[model samples]
Target: MARAQRPGSPPPGGLSVQDQAPGDRRRDSWKDSWGPARARLTDLAEDYARLLASQDPAAAEATGLPSRTLLPDVGPEALAERNRVERRLHQLVRAVETPRSLTGNHGAKDDDARDSTPGDGDPWGRAPLAVRVLRAHLLERLGTSIDLIESADQGAELNILTSPFQGVRRRLITLPTDLPGSTSSVQDWADLVDRYRAAPRALTGIRDSLAVSAAQGVLPPRGQVEAVARQTDDLARILASQARGDLSGGGHAAPGGALGRDLQVAANDAAQAVSDLGRYLRGELAPLTPVREGVGPSRHACWVRRMLGTSIDTAEVYQWARQELVDVVAAQDALAAEVLGTGSRAGDLDAHLRADPSTGMSPEDFPRWAQGVADEAWDAVVGRLLDVPDGLGRPTVLLDTPGGGVHYEEPEPSRSLSGRVLRSFAVGDETVWPWAERTTVLHESVPGHHTHSGAQSLDPSLTLWQRYLGKVPGCNEGWALYAERLAIETGLLSKPADRFGWLAARRWRIVRVLVDLGVHSWLPVPAEIAALPGAGGGTQWDRPTVEAALRAHTVLGEGFLQFEVDKQLGWPAQGLAYMLGERVWLAGRERAQHRAEEVRKKLDLRAFHNRGIGLGSVGLDLLIRELG
Candidate 1:
């Protein structure tokens, strides 16, 4: 009875399993039984993911699970349940990831070596072999998530003005699909009111948590406090402005129907509650807020780890960002010279192009116009540049309310084929400069998010857990950032404005790295950076200083700058993910191209792109290793 080689053990050299041929069965007898081990681990990994989604109704809805209710129960008990589930999950993941101390023999005389059946079905035939590798990949991701469950947005549990709570109000507006006259809409309106009435108690829980966090010196920065409070006020104002209107932003002047009267009553209560919550944040939470911007080195690492799924030295990242900003600005200046004259600065160029009504899309009509931008960008890219095997589906574009940032929601493959991109026209009375809007559409939809994320969701080779939990923001958003540049590289940026958009977007992202690193790592601001923003040099990296720098360097509008500054302060490392993620992606891509050049092989960029997408948000390090 020969023993099996433990799974994941390296060969004679330090070569990985990925380096070996799939048919190489030169192992002990227990190697034959390793199939059961692989099956059991992946089987449980898929199950745990569904169980995790079941606890949070928002998550359940987002991932296409059965939601117990329309609105999630945001109570202390719910929080406790979340913590328990995460810890248990962490333990389970660790169990699979850790190498077994000894190998088992699966000989005919060793029937005792057979521990147990993984499940009733031998999904061996149905499930892809890559799932085993993906499960190991998910271990790192789940470990990071488990940490985030304990840390990161603990502030959300205490603060009602935070994005997640605001999302409750925003999601209600989108969820009820039927018209205002339909019974479904009437029920939806009633549910909105129930959640609104529940807001006070839910908010008080957060208020208490903030108080607790405040005592621990965990207060959010002054800018974040101001931003959320302002957004909360906006919510209240919108409700009040549309007081006679229905939940879907339409006026129902003469409100008298079956549940319409109750709907009106509920709407009134929810509106009042939202207003009260805003008042609470401004009045009660403001004084306790810290004026300081940095969250210190210790917590910053946690943020980076949780956000990127890897640990990194913030000091190194900050240094890299500082250098990249200079390079990006130089390229932007060159593009500005080509598009506008050599003498034309980005700011003046932006002003000139947007001067006419025909030059740019109005921020107000962005939701209506973005559909075509996405459709056109995809038509230009796929087969021409990259491949989309399953064909494209238009993203469900939604107008994001206050606090909801621009993002893509991967549709639950179970419910529908299409994913959604949330475009925030948070800019009030502003213009989305011609090229900038197109690049973002590419980033958030079409060749960017929908292409990168949608492909993974549709990939039959992936497991349910892989699609749901495997997203590393660095990988996903990095691809999106890369996709923006792909538009220009592929000659898709035919318009001068489109070229400007590429430079403008890249410059903004570079600045984001600078601002985020500066905010979180206490990086020493240089004279070059001070000149970059053209806001006059400043040592302190506060809201005013950062805003001035953005104005000086990037072509982003004042409204967006304000939003960007507030988000950077509130979210910290997250703002940096676009550029930083792109940095990793570029490194991996460069590695592939350089290797291909060395071999004198024509590197099919499309194949390299597909390989990364197929991995479904595996960590950058693992992705790189596999790429090699």
Candidate 2:
């Protein structure tokens, strides 16, 4: 979708500071050839966005869910086609908007630049003719595509055509803190307020639209509307509190700082845009819609293509997830039985996991303990397990006292390529230790997301687009889960407590599959499934009737259930990524393992992983070839 820009035009989004390679002259030729096609693709994306905005008015009203479209159920081919369309859109944008221009004045500047950034893997290349033709159709429809989401009078809809994706551009900057020398931070409560002010107003519209849709009965019940409203309110309050120095210490919005605050504003705008656009689905635009049981396979495929940046049959992925769960659970159960005793049933193992005294560590020393665990894990990887990249700078692990889980934020492109793995301090029980600490380190730091992801981004051979933008969910999360298993192979799970912890983590993923299947596919959601005997009812949860509530809204759960339900409910396809990605990783690992005849050969696991990742954000089909 490369467009003709006035020569020396600033990059879209005021991101002018990031270093970028000059556009190749040969690429310009390809851009010229693809220009018409790219425009058509943009139209398709706009149409698809409108469809999403208006998907479910009744449900939106009842649950207050953002007026977003769900990915349609479809076969693989259609999904891939949709991806092509989006890729074209991104390519056109990138060709016109240089990355070097993304550095300043993100407020309005970034919005203008979003359509110009080549992203989601639609990089300039010598593509096939089919892609060229598809691009042409997309360009042809680009101008009128927005009409798909609107009524005769310009109302928005709730299908895959309208709400959430309407105003989407890859990166939304709410606060200005992302700029170097900016003092506003997500960590600072005051900066949070500033960021909210700058956030996109879409969310507010989304909330308001749902409320209206609910009252009109075009959306779901009041409960659903309330649920969404509550979420929106929570986000608003969180920003307000942080800004006012109520929840955390409020800090001044430093000069050139407050990007995080700005990001919040963008988030809000995204919400409002969704709601405003959702009006099409429940109101004037409903009559002309195609008749089906919700969005049919074709539409779902379109949605998947748009969201994932590739066309993937979500139903197929779900089937794969289901099978993987069966296999993983079966294998783990057998292992657990063997470890506990030959006669031990799952219940017995559960009892052991619950009653094991070693699992309990005092929470008061939690920060020191958590930091120590991260340090220990880091020690093993640095100059030992794998060659830590010298250019990665000094990696740091921090404890997040609130969220009680670990995640890593890689260094900004302007900063060193290092990363930070953070474990939330919110959950204070020592009972989560041994496994929690080990898995957190494995997943968040060494040999997991941070280490692998950081290195790849820093690799000089990779293009700026590939380095920073090549994030494939399957590869990223799948590799991390595989890394956890690798930790076990390296005896990282040596102690019983450690093993128990690993099992607990594994259980969490398994539960995600079950919950997603239960909620989305209309399967049964148990009130209480297998639990450790003395684990103190680890988070009482309401289990919905999956079949009865199919395409219906379910209340949020707490604890493990909370993660499972909330994620599955809010973001489709995310819950399945863990196991689905692990499946792909395990296949690659087994292949690599088979190739290495000697123990020493198999020992170079890092090499195998690096090879797999070097392929860049490709589909599973491409990954299979790369792994081979």
Candidate 3:
């Protein structure tokens, strides 16, 4: 985690005041400069954070927020209260006016920047960059929450990932052990048992909400219901096994102890509740749910804005993604030709790569190997490609719970822990593919999520709400995708096999954009894409057709492919964020570079990266306005 110091620069811990940009220097005096308006915004943000924590326990735990509830209350009354609080917060934010002195307008004739704001007459439109960023974030996030509630999407949400069912299980499984402020004391163990005991009531609330949504003619897709039911069954088995002291692996208290016996009893009860929910999902909900997986254009549009923090023309973006996929596949084909001594399709190249002995590692060695890759990437990028703070140390690489997929988790808000890059593998799966994972290591660790998120965690300029709750998936995922491409452009993917792996992963994201749009927005599959081998005889996008397309274009296994498709279908507009976010990142960087050239000054990529990452998580529009 050690960072090398740059010549004539401040030490690695953080940037000195003199080294910061004029705007950043202004931000350093944020508390003193903004005065009353800043205080009001801070208060409002804190209020919203508390409200959010109450509504989503999983999010609360993830961000290290203190929560009285172990699980989210998803009943009708809770949903209504959540909506009311969001609306009230939104109104309060809208009413807060910024002081004109700190606005930094300087009477500039920047129409592009001006147009990005709410309007000329709006108080927030004339606010400082930081104030505007906060205001915009709150407005969009609150607006999205209100919209989801009013549209009934919030009530009817049953997804393969991120739904209440999964949230409850994930929280319980992690419990007091992994959370912030947890000492793993007897009280902590008792609290864990209490949470386990509360599982039925929380799950029952979820079940009731789903049933109510169904009665009101708002039901999730049958595919999602089935997928979640299967997941519930899996969770039931996991919990049941834990109750029997089979899977604890010394992570829990001694099985023979009183606390352990209490936990076992509670877990068994929780497992029975989960099993009941699964049965209800299969026997009751699935019969009434629609067979079509898409949430249709309206809901999809709302999710697009919510997830991306910007609006997109679905047809245009879909067409653009189609061409991007073509380009990526062509690049992969060329790489395959050079590496394998013959040109091959993407799927063929992936198969060959998977079959290569040198590409595989045993499961036991995977974490250590991944850590090495992450460490190497950290050493390669710091001070050269990015100005990483010394406090933002290298993330730990660990194996995650099965089926969680590879992802990066930020450090706790307390800063007592470093970030972690979790590599999820299927249960009993032996071989780990490292060739295709090198770029992913870069994407999840150095110069990617950990770098981006760790920077946010260490930034004193950011408010607690901004650091913890201000995530825009498009900005975050886009930056990670950009980081992956950055590694490729910098020759970090040194081996041909690794390069091909990067290309394949890139192609997979492109395919996601296509399928996400095609399914959710009901867009037609392009003629050329339909003509591809194994695309099946379908003019329209369906689960099978989408899966087939993924199979042909990427190297994901059948289980992962099914999971990915179900996830995309269940979580509309989410799959498109990675590439869409990357688009903004690249364009924003290019525009910054061009502006620097116009001013006859060389653009520093390191500084540009630092500034962008320092912005925490804002929308693409806000990102462009701030960076530009």
lDDT of each: 0.63, 0.45, 0.78
Estimate candidate 3's alpha-carbon lDDT, on a 0 to 1 scale: 0.78
Candidate 2 residues lying further than 4 Å off, grouped into runs, are: 1-225, 235-342, 350-359, 362-364, 370-388, 413-417, 425-431, 521-543, 546-560, 592-606
Best by TM-score: 3
* Alpha-carbon deviation at 172 in model 3, angstroms: 3.7
Residue-wise lDDT of candidate 1 within 1-628, one digit each (tens)? 0112334565645666567654443332234445555656667667666765664566675556675544544444555566676677666655653224233222313222222223333322122225344555766766665564456345443222345565565643433443322444455565655655555555555555555556666666666666677666766665554345544434433235755565455556656766776676778777876677766566666678766766777778777777876676666667668777777666666776767867666666777778878777867877666666463466766666544257887755455547777777553546565566777777888779888877777665566667665567777888898887787787667687777777777777777777777777667666666655444366756666677767766655566667666667666577667777777778878877987899799877877776667667766565654454
Structural similarity to truth (TM-score) of each candidate = 0.77, 0.56, 0.86
Question: Among these predicted structures, which one has the highest lDDT?
Answer: 3
| Decreasing lDDT order of the candidates | 3, 1, 2
- Residue 595 C-alpha lDDT in model 3: 80
**Residue 432, candidate 1: alpha-carbon lDDT:** 62
Q: Where is model 3 poorest over a 10-residue stretch in terms of lDDT?
A: 1-10
Evaluated against the true structure, the overall lDDT of model 1 is 0.63
lDDT of 3 by residue, 4-43 (tens): 1222445335878788777655543542344567568878
Q: In candidate 2, where is summed lDDT lowest over 10 consecutive residues?
A: 147-156
Better of 1 and 3 by TM-score: 3
